[model samples]
Target: MSRREFTQAIDFRHGRVDMTHGGGGRAMAHLIEALFVKHFDNALLREQNDGAAFALPPGTGRMVMATDSHVVSPLFFPGGDIGCLSVHGTVNDVAMAGGQPLYLAAAFIIEEGFPLADLERIVVSMARAAREAGVPIVTGDTKVVEQGKGDGVFITTTGIGVAAPGIELSGDRARPGDAILLSGSLGDHGVAIMSARENLALDSDLVSDTAALHRLTAAMLECAPGLRCLRDPTRGGLASVLNEFADQSECGMHLREEAIPVKPQVAAACEILGLDPLYVANEGKLVAICPPEDAERLLACMRAHPQGRDAAIIGEVTADPNHFVQMSTRFGGVRMVDWLTGEQLPRIC
Candidate 1:
């Protein structure tokens, strides 16, 4: 067939991906040009090069890179799909280092027989997410697997960013007397995924809080340049992040259970499932640790941002020979907030 005829022959609405789509031949090229390239059309991507190239600001300082893989069970979930989740997860990973995300690369592993219409929807969602985050998807690869051997789709995304000069953030930066600030409520993403999976009847509507947090991170950086540590509680949730800080910084964490925000719907869902909100995942929330003196200022700055409107100071760091994460109960008692032993919710991005 002629080039024009080949391009026009694709039945995007009714077609299904087959082995030829991954054969690196005409079929692959057609699929890419029609779908992936059509949606993620940045100048660098337009070049059709094996890799993306772009110059950084002259003095932008250290370059940061983060990679994430998304294999959520249901391709489409409440408020988000795997596409946006892949983009948002990688972007937030880069941002957690106090950096500005610049570019992204994506890879897709698709199963044979997957619907072209569904694939297009996912590509569009990814494109929208990258565009909204102001981070272009400059390069990508697509591969197809046998139908029964793979899930419908899996995505892996890599993000590159530049951290400003003199900005240092890591789990080990939590110092004694440092305040632990949580950006917004916890367990939204995890609960949303679980509710969608189990078809739970929640009192209030719930949606996954999947979002790119680089802008919120930027706002926090502007106000708290000396921020010690930042972490987006994802797979293992807020409790894991606190435990990580304690272990890395060799200090204890003291959290007030009442101060950590949990939405009504999410709380109720967790109660029904016998899950602790602390151990649930969150895609859009962040855990920040900064000097005690800068706690209020940082909280105010975070609250000013759309993504962090419910930011709160949930805890503080303490000097302890044995690192431990403890929580002050609402009933005037304290207990150790130990790490989660088993998976509460699986395959939640």
Candidate 2:
């Protein structure tokens, strides 16, 4: 049904979602057309088909696909909300494989009493994020749940991308002597969420580092085509990503304590909360492994980008049969950067 056929518009100012909105009737069609279709308007989505269809450009190499679900508490947080976070999370996943994200599909689960105004805000944010990333939300689904059974809202985003020929990246590609690079400071996203959740008043303003990194990955691949691996540290933080790389490649990572970057505010927060920045989550930061010879070029390329102004060569890969991740403390002693044993923060992503 066309939106023009509806006699009245959705009450964005003072209306709540109910079971009828998701009942697959005229109410559902009107809700979708008035809100989602209006915000995420595009040729593909306008078709109103069960699925999206399009042709890929000739010479486009292997197709890459990734999906992520956002169940963050509070729904809204500093720097970003679940809407944009959902888009960035999946885009980065595809980017980590050295691919250019082409399109996205989103699925929303909203509670019965969710405010329409809040839902519109999230949908608009998602549309803006997709536009900035040069990707489109070509298709989606929406469902309503009982008020108490569902959280305010949950979003799951899936992305499809294309990797150019001869560009390959994987966790198992790291080799001994490769240089390890980090995009920026850690724990900003996690700390920001914690502060907002606990209502902690900190001296400095902190925000989540949620951003799409496909552009950064493209630049890095152009500058250093020999990159061995790329991975974003999310729920388990930098520590978990390094441990995964080590185990996958059967190598050890030796990191310098002083080389790792951490904002002072985040560091202070971690200390006060009995958390380690290394174990805290980050949304916009990424870890890249490249040959020692290509390290300087890759760092230069990354540092030139706005998203990677704080890029640094924090460590190097080593041959270790045990596949461990170790760090040299600024105190002149070595310590094991083991895998995170327990959940430091839950619903972090």
Candidate 3:
């Protein structure tokens, strides 16, 4: 088809997209060549393999690989969409293990009747995120389904990273007297998504804290190489994450209610939604544990960084072999910070 004909045949602004775009026909090829490739173009992606392959960096010790699928409703939500969320989510997952994210692979499942303009916007956002994070989208696949078979779009992302020599950290590493630190305020991402999806009343300032946490991780690791554990409080939130550590490490935990950070707006939104901020999801925050001796130094390092400016020493590992998480309430009462049993919200990234 001639350029004019192709341009005329495919609607860019107001076109109602169809399944043919994923049918491996001229339309499909045109979309890939014109949009996806244009922005994510790189030496690795240009080769187009089922997976990316490359030599490891010298001194690379442990290899870390993490995969996450993004099916957030509304496709676009406050502060971020599925595209940027996919990139940051996987990056944070890998970084939580004290790894430096090196590469990313993405796959898109798009609805047939979705808008081309929206798809282009999402892909561009993904490109920008990958570039800004210094992680390349080395390989990817795109599949289309009938209108009813899919949401607007779903993204599956896998990240590969490398850990430095001799560094060891795991859920089972938490021990009594170890200090627990939170990167920043909690529940911002989940509440933002909830408000956006329901069209609930909210201030424009309320937004999802979606960001890459690898740099902040590096800073913390540098200051506290004795860091025992690292985890981004994601799906199950802070309570679940701490419970997992306690169970695995065969240790109990004690948290200071006043030390755990939660933004006032997020706290208010969670109260209105009948949700506990402890059970709400967070995209840009993380939980880190280190030797008691390393706590102050690590907090200082975290505070010096922009992403972790609100870092706080919320708790400490306990001696109980039963592995319970307890908290010192703001009102001077001690309470159990148990595992989260119910879903706080669904389709929340």
Candidate 4:
């Protein structure tokens, strides 16, 4: 069937997705045209092909790809939903590689009986995020599962990017005497999720710090092209990311508790929940490891960016056969920041 066969438009306000929408029939086409394509309209997507194809400009440099799936509970949270989170997650992954994101591919797994209004809202949010980040969603797929078998919706986004020329970044590139820097406060996203899930009201307004960081990484590369490594402390938070750096580079890390920046409200919330802020998740933050000589300059540059305004030099790399991440406490004691033993938060993107 063609446009003419779609006699009536989808009742987005009152309609719920059913099996026929995923049956590769008229209903599927109608849904795609009325929902996904309508919001994600772009030159590449207009072709309506199985996959999007486009030409890369000259001197595009090395290509990088990263994919992530979002299944955070309570799809709609205080500051963000799974839609924008999906875009930011994969885009940040590509940025950590010193790459400039170009395009994105999204795939949705929606359950039967899910509200069309909510699905449309998600798609619209995703489109807005892609537009703001200067990346386009050029292709995608959709699948429907039985109501009880699936969550409300799951989003998987794949991002494609091009690395900056003459700059190579990797997890194992950190060396002894390098400096570690954090973008902003820790545990905002995780805390926001918990607050919404448990319906707790706090004195201060807390929201998820979910935003794109490609521009911030680009600025860091411009300021200190010799930066060794960059990593986003997402699910496992700052401690986990530092440990990963130590294990990969076979080095130790010495951190100052006072230098780490944690919002007072977040700190209080963590204390109340019997959780350590270091192990909490962050959506819009990054950890950068650079040579000791360039640390100050890079820190200055990062502090000037919106995404990194609260940036701080939290630690320094050291030579230790044991590869431990130790932190100096405000009370004049030292402790080991080891790998998280088990899952602190589940279904947290």
Candidate 5:
């Protein structure tokens, strides 16, 4: 029989893995076809090569690339884990530049004794995320370390995206007077993970906002095709990203406390943990800066989308040589939303 026919009939459902399963042999080929290919079965993947080859949508646009390493503590959480989070994280990084996420490559670093079932579950989650986002896991790599040398699992992801023509979006493009728009509530992702790990009691459905935002970003483009700047408030949260913009654009940002939305439970949890919600990370939200003329239309468009149901115009860019991010408190006071002094929380993303 031909090679294709031989692979087609491999038993996937009843397969018990061994070292040979990853040893580049018949077992490896069978494993790849039976598991990975079955889930990520797009035309490009059907070619069965080391890499996928495909064309971008018809447009003379710039290609965007982003990579991220996710070592979030617990592999599984309320809404997602490292698997789907890796996909959403990289996708948002590219989408923040007004790009549409097109493809992804994943690499897994697994400890020697990690459960095979857990690895399969993570792989399946990654596949599901890629398919749902209309992106493909075109290529991937896997490695195993000795029993005591590694964590349970770590995933690194790289994404390729396409940006529209004539669009110049960046941290340096946040001009004074530009309106700052937030896609939704803050700190959900970080809080959800923390609660899950600490086993803190909280209401159900308090899920991580881990999601792919390119589609919502596409909607933003539809309203304000000339979007000036965009960013995903991760790592150092909304505070750090805004400060980066302030430094890049040589501007200041004045945020209205009331305008920034945070779920009550997230706020309560932050208070209990002595953490600031503004400094906590979020996986699915985006902060966009655009001309005032486009703010109304952009926020309206954002609110109409499922990912952006809590969209709000949070702040405005200003001319401040110090490049500070200041805030007007809800209690009628002014203060500085300074750069993240030291790591307030680690392993946050």
Candidate 6:
């Protein structure tokens, strides 16, 4: 059939995806034009080429890249969905490197019989997130699998960014006496997902903390150019991030339990679920380590941002032969914050 004929023949309103959508035939083209393109209409994507082509301005600085896959069950959540999560995850990954994200590329795997309406909603959410972050989805690919072989949809997003000169952030950069900073409250995203998945009755205010962190990172960079390291505490929450820093820098981390921020609702939900907030997950929050002297200025800078209003100095790096992570309890005790043994919450991101 001709392109116009195919476009007119698609029943987007009542249709469900079949294997033909991934057959790379007319059906695929119709789906792309009607759904994906209609929502994510950007110049690079409008070219409809296999890949996006562009030139960077002179002195844009070192280029950074990051990629993430989103298989979170329940496509829709209280504060976000798989679509926004895919975008935020990769964008934050690049930003954690002290980079300003530039563009994004997405790939989708959709199960056969997935609803067109849900797919459209996901695509729209993705577009809005990329736009808000000032990053456009430049190119992408879509595939459909057998009904039972795949979940409703899985999205993988790849991000590209440019790091400013004199800005270097890595796990190994932390040194003894470096202050450990947390961007905000912990376990918000994890609690939100668990509550929604288990049908738990909780306060209506709970929602995923998924968000882009490039702006907040930029602000902190301005105040503390010597920022030692930056990491987003995502999959394993705060505990996992501290452990990673300890291992990478070959230094121990000492966290103050009272200093780490956790909302009352989130903490209560964790208690009912028999989960530790530190072992839970967060998307928007970050773990930053800076020189002790720079900590005050940096903390003030972070607090000035909307995303970092609840930022605090939760801990500090220490010299230790074993490179362990230990936290001081509020009751005047201390315990090890080891690496997550098993998957606490699978497919969370």
Compose the digit string of candidate 6's lDDT tens values, residues 23-106. 998889888888777788888888889999998757887899999999998789889999999999999999999999989999
| C-alpha lDDT of all candidate models, in order | 0.91, 0.93, 0.89, 0.92, 0.84, 0.91
> How well is each residue in 79-177 modelled by candidate 5, as lDDT tens digits?
897888988999988898777888888777777667766767777898889989988888776665666777788899999999888778888988888
The worst-scoring run of ten residues by lDDT in candidate 6 lies at 1-10
Q: Candidate 3, residue 53: CA error in Å?
A: 2.5
TM-score of each: 0.97, 0.98, 0.95, 0.97, 0.92, 0.97
lDDT of 1 by residue, 158-216 (tens): 99999999999999988999999999999988887887774665544788999999999
Tell me the TM-score of model 5.
Answer: 0.92
Which tens-of-lDDT digit does each residue in 65-102 have in candidate 2?
A: 99999999768889999899999999999999899999
- Estimate candidate 1's RMSD in Å: 1.8
Worst 10 residues of 3 by lDDT: 1-10
- Tens-digit lDDT track of model 3 for 1-349: 2242355445667775688777877887677667777788888877656677799999999999999999998788889999999999999999998899999999888888888889888999999999999999888878899989998999999999999987788999998999999999999999888888756766546899999999999888888888999999998899999999999999999999999888999888877878889989999999999999999999999999999999999999999977999999999999998988867678889
Model 5: CA > 4 A from native: 1-30, 199-205
Deviating ranges (above 4 Å) for candidate 4: 1-4, 199-204
Q: Which residue pairs clash within candidate 6?
A: none
Q: Show pairs that collide, candidate 1.
A: none
Best by TM-score: 2
Predicted model with the maximum lDDT: 2
Q: Write the per-residue lDDT of candidate 4 for residues 1-349, one digit (tens) a residue.
A: 2343688899999999988888878888888888888888888887778899988767988999999999999899889999999999999999999999999999999999999999999999999999999999999988889889799999999999998678899889999999999999999998888887756565458999999999999999999999999999999899999999899999999999999999988899898888899999999999999999999999999999999999999999999899999999988999999899899988777
1 or 5, greater by TM-score: 1
lDDT score, residue 258, model 4?
Answer: 96
- Ten-residue region with minimum lDDT total, candidate 2: 195-204
Over 4 Å off in model 6, which ranges? 1-9, 198-204
